[model samples]
Target: MTAALWPLQQAVYAKLTGHAPLIALVSGVYDEVPEDAAHPYVTLGSITEDVDDAHNQRGLEASVVLHVWSKYRGFKEAATILAALDTALDRQPLPVAGFKDVSVAHQQHTEVRDPDPDIRHINVSYRVWLTKS
Candidate 1:
């Protein structure tokens, strides 16, 4: 079995970082946000994979989550970022290094009011399906 997480992530990163709308609206999208990072940025979050042994092919299905962090004092900015994330990944074709027919889609999302009150966060989950080449 092969893990397609890295490849999918790379494709997604490229999409988001290259998007002018997303870039202009937020500080940036990151796999790991740096310390002292500016507000209004997106970060890659947890990923869970489940083995998918099919008829004769080994496959994998994964749930990947992303977090949108903002300090805009309201949900507006966070929602905007979340929309961009959805546009970038939902039903988008992701090219995985060692896999073929990779597909990713927006699964679910949640808006949370952080305890800090000064910050807002939205968590989005994506479902990915891929088969070994």
Candidate 2:
């Protein structure tokens, strides 16, 4: 699944649970840039300055994390939910313009098995970072 979906999943989960969710962003520091880019290249200088300012004003940087759990029998269902969430986020407008750079920092999926297990669970975690505009 594409990395973009975590934020959307977190948003949905938060709405359902009425609590903060944990998500993992899965992007690398040196990931290659696409051959065809639409926007001007962003530099660390701009990102750092903006994040620092935002942090100062908010007293903390803004971020979203999502943790999803489901029975092993429903692993595919869970994945589908996450994928749909990603697509929704891509098509939707940001809640605020301050979120300029929304990127994935890490992602992980784990499964547990037990011989006497009545039901298995699949867990997906996502972490994301955002800088205020």
Candidate 3:
């Protein structure tokens, strides 16, 4: 399950960010989101198991992170990225039984870092839930 979920999260990141390098740079950003997002960054950042019970009896929990940059910082870019992510996930081909329930509990811009005082790094996090189909 961890192996499968990791790839799914990567796909989500690709769909939202549209670039590979940017995603790799700020993987830690995903940890900042409120717990409500349900592993939102799963699509973008590396996944570390927070809690897992045998046979997924208690389900799985993971953390995700993503970083982005732009001349402008606002919701337009965030919204667009999120929308694209949703579309991408919807179009994905699930396993034979498929996913029963998938939910994103939170979405927020957790941080803005300026290295040169001119360039900004935008970090976003979200929580996601996946159930059997």
Q: Model 1: runs farther than 4 Å from truth?
A: none
Models 1 onward score TM values of 0.92, 0.35, 0.47
Ranking by TM-score: 1, 3, 2
Candidate 2 residue 40 Cα shift, in angstroms, is 42
Model 1, 1-133: lDDT tens digits are 8777677677778878887878888888888789978999999888888987689988899898999999997799999988888777889667778887778889999999998989999999999888888
lDDT, ranked from best to worst: 1, 3, 2
Candidate 3 lDDT by residue in tens digits, 23-121: 443232242455554211322445443444447544344444555443344435444444444443333432312344444534455545466554444
Estimate, for each residue in 21-70, the C-alpha lDDT of model 2 and write its tens digit: 21222111112335553221210111111233343533123334333333
Clashes of each: 0, 17, 16
TM-score of 2: 0.35
Residue 70 lDDT (model 2): 35
True-structure lDDT of candidate 1:
0.85
Please report the TM-score between candidate 1 and the true structure: 0.92
**Judged by lDDT against the true structure, how good is candidate 2?**
0.35
